[model samples]
Target: MPGCFINYRTGDGEHVATLIDRELKQRFGSGEVFRASRSIDAGQDYVRALDAAVRRCEVLVAIIGPAWLDSPHRSGGDGRALDDPDDWTRREIATALSLGTPVIPILFDGAARLRPADLPEDMRGLARCQNRRLHHRSAESDLADIIEAVEVAAPRLGDMGEDESSEGDSGQSSGGGVANTMRDVSGGTVAQSREFHGVNGISGRTGDMVFGNSGPVNTGTGPQYNGSTVHNGTGDQIGVQRVHGSRNGGESR
Candidate 1:
């Protein structure tokens, strides 16, 4: 069963919905999130599939973009899409509300807070529920907040998410702590800390350094030097030299 259902308008909030689905699937498991585009199979009765998914989901996220409230109706009517009784976005939200599922309103891309007057009668209650904001500049933090909220609302899903996370972390060495493997180090050092728990390994190249580690591993990169001399801690001398074409160079003391 899906732990969360994403309700979003096709042309208005679809992108945001996809983002939410991807993030949630990463945090929770793939089976825990239900998005119409991915969850519904070809030749399946879409209506029935949507209804079943909505009913079974523990939480419903209503992705409201700037144009969501006033988008054109599917039937080419002049009124807003939400005003139409047949609008899938409207129906999905209504069904989730009727089922007493926790409906979370996610304001996206500078969308304003929902007002009761702007919603159809059935969806007016959505305005009363607390909302979370997702902006491009603050997406990471916002996503974290959404995940935390979901964890609190559905503890079972939370447990499963944690398990999956731990499994990815376990691929790193035992002594490695959680850290950001990807960072900008153009001018100075960037320190990152991350907690790992799962079987996923870190493998990537940033600048001149290449990292491929399985098991808990902490790595860092700093300024490279060519034929530089340095004093050892015990008053000894050491020389550092970089081979022109090689990633690793020999050091002599």
Candidate 2:
């Protein structure tokens, strides 16, 4: 039986989810966790299947991103309607809470801090239950949190073969401290647009990147970039990649 149900968005945190699944499998034997990527039956009721999996699990590990807060199940700001009646994320959270399952909220890429005021009230409650600030740190820090949360909620989860210490004893040992892993705005490396959660692109030999745009600008020679604007030697616009704003088409060498 699966001991933990890991919830996550397939778009941004897929890699993280896979990593967690791998770790869980290593820590606990195989088939201890259910991940969507491992499709069991063809044409199965995926939502129902996932819900059932959650029901059987002792822990619901919510691998959250910014998208989780704005889910359709929760009311948007000012009682705005959600787009769906049975949002998977909302149902997953509700099921976990209803079943008294420990919903350990895991922050992916510091998404908890990015929550907007427009988020729904119920979603806010979920956020309050397991704050990113309390546990939202780097992947390494989160691993420690995961170990702690599971130990607290499901003491018999992983193998205690060589390790005689009980999870309950070890879980409470780790301090409830939050670690700061945010990149330095002043000196840290800026993640390229293509490398962001929402954007995708390919890099060229000159370190320029190109993405979704099929316009002539993307076809231009010299270094091609996927940012908002490309700069030449004189700091003039050579091409524009408007992700969410105006574009200026100019040529510079």
Candidate 3:
């Protein structure tokens, strides 16, 4: 069973959730962390799979972006998506809470601390849970801290992490499967996170392609440009000019 379950709205903190899943798996083995979209395969009963994962997990990491609670109340209801009985995000969190599973609420994308009054009756207890903040600028450190919290909540991970130090493999999983992609991406400046091993530089044209990161950038009203020019170092570079491999994780919708 996956010791950790990552929960987030598709369009909200999904990217952060993906990042968390990737990092956690690396530190604690691939089977220890589960993200529904990536963990559930085609034709599977996703409803049952989601519930099983939540119930089996020792910890649930709730990725709450700014829109998590601010979303429009469904069907003219009082609260937001939580008011909807069918909302998977709400259901997952509620199920975990109901089972008394330790939940780690991660605030990202400028999300504020969840307030008890903002939560519906079934989830008000969520507001009382101690939380952590994840920011883009402090991603590495924040993730390190979050991992520490996970280790505490899911004591099972303590033994797994001891022998799974991926210290040398982190960030090198670049340009893996489906390394580069561009689809339905219109105009504007496209930016993505990339890692080059001993490479001096890289550049691409308007119609060129590069891969990795949350998703393609959508720059409405502006032209999209993904080309880049940078100097890695002043020395004679001895680097792999090209990187190609299967992507290690799932892409955003």
Of the candidates shown, which would achieve the greatest TM-score relative to the real structure? 1
Tens digit per residue, CA lDDT, model 2, 55-103? 8888887777656454433344442222243566656766777677777
Error of 2 at 119 (Å): 5.3
Quote each prediction's TM-score.
Answer: 0.66, 0.51, 0.63
Query: On residues 1-253, what C-alpha lDDT tens digit does candidate 3 reach at each position?
Result: 8999999887788789989998898778778888988999999999899989999999999999888886755456676677787888888889899999999999987788988998877788789999998998999999999998998888889755643443223422322322233445555443333332333243322222344433334322233222243234675544344423332232322
Query: Ranking by TM-score, best first?
Result: 1, 3, 2
- Runs in model 1 deviating more than 4 A are 165-253
Backbone collision count in every prediction? 20, 0, 9
Which segments of candidate 2 are over 4 A away from where they belong?
71-83, 113-125, 131-138, 158-253
Higher-ranked by lDDT: 2 or 3: 3
RMSD of each: 11.0, 20.1, 16.7
Checking candidate 3 for backbone clashes, the offending pairs are 176-245, 176-246, 176-247, 177-245, 177-246, 177-247, 187-224, 188-223, 188-224
